[model samples]
Target: MGFREGNLGALGHGIRHRTTITTCLLMAVFFVCYTNREFLRFPVEHELSTALDDHPPNTLKLSDVQGVSTVSGDHPANSLTLSDAQCTALFPHAFDEIELALSRGPVKRSLDKITNGHVRARIYNGALYLTDRGLDVWHRQSAILHQIHRAIVTAPSPSELPNINFEFSVNDHPSGDVWSLARSDADKQVHNTWLMPDFGFWSWPEPHIGSLDEVHDRIIKTEGSMTWEEKESKAVWRGTVKWNKGLRGKLLDVAWDRPWSDVQRLNWSSNALAMEDFCRYKYLIYTEGVTYSGRLRYFQMCRSIIITPELKWHQTTSPLIRSAGPDQNIVIVKDDWSDLAETIEYLEANPEHAERVANNTVRTFRDWYLRPAVETCYWRKLFRAWAHVTPPVGQLYPEERGTRWESFILMHRLHWGKNA
Candidate 1:
């Protein structure tokens, strides 16, 4: 009996020992997993790295994995940084205006067509030369020149630029392949005028509106601070009525004393709301002044539903507006603004839809299309496209034609021409 009891006790002890060993093994595994929790949670990252190792270096660009198309929200991701190629790829419709202008066929307007209020320039041997500044009064030519320089310097292959001569007008009216800030579709059919990105892309010297980037940053911060629900439930507009009395006057009549109206005639002499503050309202009313309003892009920077008439004029960025259905970013009213009240009522009733429209605006303009990277890409593409359509510039005498752009900008007194 004593021997049998001893055997059972030894067996019981062995079972306890094995149980402890099993517990210890489990504890060791748990400890290892706990220590490397983050790594274990994202094992795909390691797998991806391992897979990447098998490929040659430079096989994948940063853009390949982190392109804007991967982004999925209404608000822009803070970490998103698009490469030039990515920017170009993301906004495929950006250069539509340029394409339309070139569609009329290769540029046939001679340099002589550039008269007063215009500038003639050439890109030759990877350098910019300013041949003439045709009585430019507003210093818009300077801004345009600087933007071109900015685009060229930041370009991937600045040293390999094509030799092309072009002319641009800073004035309101431009025709016959002379690059201008904005042109109507009607004007496009009548005139083979090319359109460049507006001067406001660089800066707007008005006290109310400063540089485009600076204003955009301020708007981003302002919009970020407030929730969608916190914004004023009104359509806001402030601009001079005289610029386009037919449209602006009609808007004033429609919005006058309306519960949803925040329209006011802007008084430049007195205090006016800063451009960034315009985002405080839920809706923004866009109106063209004489031609396309330079303020349109700034309004787009806000995360508000843009309300505008059927835009008759085409700016470089006009093609981006989606006016109907789910993707509609801007709200288009009748030219007379007769439907303005009904539209506002619809938006007031359908808050989710309105918010979606606003979000779409931010996603389209501020986040993707109108971004600085996209603008730079557009400039480079413009250069290439223009070069493709224009004749090669003949021999250019730097001294006789004009000054090198580098020297021209640095001069205290900008000489207009050979006479100046």
Candidate 2:
């Protein structure tokens, strides 16, 4: 009996000793990780290590922009010094859409279809001037103007910009050498319409969706607050059924009463989900509105799998989506959505693959392409590329252009009255 007690005591002592050693080792590991936290962070690819490498070596300082010296440090003009290479690195297919728009040839100004509703503008001596005030629809025209101003004011060589004229349309559909929000594949060849960044990049106050920068910060916080495992394991969507009854309506029918679906008709007056809240679901459904839905970019910011039909309308960053292969960041089902249920089931069964797709979405959109710096870089590139297609006609007259952007914003009481 005494021998048995002695053996048990020794065993207890050994366990205590091993436990102590294990605890110490774990503490040491935690200490090392905590001390080297910065090194352990996610490697940010957008770091400005070699920013502006492709820019002219003698790039002018930001102070060269008129009235920029008085701007606050947080102003966009005070930051975002990206170069062509840096922008291309962040968004590999950045110039694809631009090249497509200008592919036909030098823009024939006579072929341009301008109406009283379209704004006639020009860049003269690196300054934006508006000769005609197009009726602002949902503040789109004004928002576009602000974006142009931002691109010019924040550029490295604002003074050296080419003198070019452009007509901007606030309509959902436009043709000719006019700049617009989006263009369909069918009309892309039929018209010389150029796609600009959505007006929401500046702000969409009526819907209370705020600016792109604000949405960026909000989505980052929301996405980081939850884990993929904790998110609802269902495909989620919310949109008005009336917008595109064929597409959006079909989605509702497919998702109706399905245990794995959380689709609902949007009640904009009450139950509309905040853009950031959509991150709580495992999958997000994207659909095009009249043209391209601006919400796609916001959804791309989330760490959730994007499930959609083959997209008809292409946005500035739409080409980056890889629907197949190892790099597939989005799940593209048929237009009729007949396979949506099976796709959702497959994703639910394969959690790891779904998470990979979600991670890729965040990496492609939030971390790199849709970033503020990339957007500004795209706008500047647009200016340079547009100047190439829009050659000066007969004479170069800078004085004939209408009101300077600074004065136009102040004088325009309808849409830009807030700036005034």
Candidate 3:
């Protein structure tokens, strides 16, 4: 019994020693692991922080227009710069359809038809008139589409048709997911807006489509007849205020009643003032309302210098101003419009420079947008590229079963242009 007790006691002591040694080794391993982790953290953190600081998102070179980086209400890094010069059309055969359309003479007829659940421009004796949709909304799309339709009617075109079946895009951005508009039952009975490759929406057929003051300088320039010397020196702006909630209102608040500029809310009903009258002034304030302004094109027609903030949403008109840059064709300010008052003051003080800038602006617009062949050329490129990329189903506006828009193209094509 005594030997057994001694042996048990010895075994207990041996077990205790083994446990202590194992515990010590485990503690040493844990201490080493903890120390190693603590040692690695500082360098890893520094390297990660350095990487983030060194290369932030959307970092761009000064001249790089490869990508657009925009913050809401703030001008992006490369917003107004132009991409490298290249041919406007993606493919060579882009204008064949347009050429064919232009060659077919006197496709003209007059119609007094009301669009079914649609609003469209009607041609009468080569004049354009808008069908009353009775939308009564003072938004950008309605106003711009109205103006472009008017331009289509009044502006000279390659095809001098008094009547034709027209299909085109809405000039303004429709309010909602743009892609969804295509997926669902298209409002085909209504004028549909389609996306062009670069920017802006395009529509078809009635289009003839800019700026210069001198009889020598003018080609299709219908407005802004006065020379820069004869014009009012103050900067002038007229537009509706409902959609341009923040930045535009700030413009009015700063410039209204100031001696150097004239700013007023546009009265929609009155066509009393002609576009030329507005252009007769030396400076025009160009700002975006809902998306982009079709008004910029009209301003281009006059001799006045266009002054605008750094552009956010470029309508189809942006590429025309690419070669012109900020200083030449149009004066660019900060998106916050920090420079509006100052720019007006400077232009008012330096009349000759302003005149020179105005002339250059008109000259740039003339070369870019107002040439005799541009109307046909633009359509040709647009149509050709569209054929190349757009699928067969897309050729006809997307249709829903039993919807009016689905039957719209066929119905119009068959029946329209019957009357003279």
Candidate 4:
């Protein structure tokens, strides 16, 4: 009886041990599967076709919907389908206004010889419009127009549309995951705000100094103290300034003078000098002897110094300036203050170079860094930052699924407007 009881007790203990081992093995398998599932999922590709496929069927397509033909393809799960009329309504009117503005410039020149003041501009949507102005209009207007035109030209046409069916799994913890679709680099830059030409310069507040005398007073008040070495060190610390060779001596002599000739004599073309002045005197109430204030001022001064009427003459006459760039938008580098002074003085002395630089300078801000590009980049950066902080949450868990699509759409619209 004792032996039988001992055998039964040992059998029961063995059974309990086996059960515990099996439970642990099952738990390990489940953990491995869950971890692999999180990592093995496909990443979101930001291409147009991929975006259309991955997003919900009701995702908004911001394109001109006119003259589109849709045919059925191998239908995948969650494919987007819309009637011809439904697609047409997606085109934004703001896009049309922009395209009309850009077309006006080319149309005006073509119509200049004709009686019709109407300039026929071809839009990206294959639509045409008439405008009275040229491309040289206000920067803000021109920028908006350019963006609209770019979007129209670049966005894929209806015939080129791809299949919009895809599969998505519900995540147990959807809030921790993020998914977004963006255009290709080229397309993104074309449509996004960061690449807009006038990004940093537009809406720049005007400088605080009203006149050159105020600038001089500010400089003297700021740098009036210290030893000769300190002054030189301060000047060096200031970064770069465009002054004539041996002008340091001249500057020292006139440091206390209310209207220092050095201000007028200071070379504006030297980016180094301009940068130095900005760095040194940025916080000073007076002119730390910097030409303009801020980075925009530095850029403008560089442009002015490089493309002045005198510099243009050098391009035509002297071989030096002509050797700089293929597109004449080249920046010339100088070795020292003397070199800068000589370049500026030489250009000023030469009539041909002077005229070229003058013409080029006038055209630079108008043609290149206009307002539209600036506003776009500004808005885009803002949007991207916002998106990063508060990522979009899609329908996944029961809680998210319960929310209405309209609520999501409304939230996105509100975000865009607020950021704008």
Write down the TM-score of every candidate.
0.77, 0.77, 0.46, 0.26
What is candidate 1's lDDT per residue for 65-87, written digit by digit as tens? 33233344322212233334444
Local accuracy of candidate 3 as per-residue lDDT tens digits, 128-227: 3343332332232333343334334333341343232333323344322110011112353222223222111222111112221232133234443556
Q: Give the 10-residue window scoring lowest on summed lDDT in candidate 1.
A: 73-82
Number of the top candidate by lDDT?
1
Per-residue error (Å), model 2, residue 9: 99
lDDT of 3 at 16: 100
Model 2 agreement with the true structure over 110-154: per-residue lDDT tens digits: 534446457887887778887665454727777888988988887
- Order the candidates by TM-score, highest first: 1, 2, 3, 4
Full-model lDDT for every candidate: 0.75, 0.74, 0.47, 0.29
Off by over 4 Å in 2: 1-79, 110-113, 187-189, 393-398, 413-420
Candidate 4 lDDT tens digits, 244-328: 2333333333332332112333333553242324323211111222211223323222223331112211000122123243324
Q: Report lDDT (Cα) of residue 252, candidate 4.
A: 35
Candidate 2 minimal-lDDT segment of 10 residues: 49-58
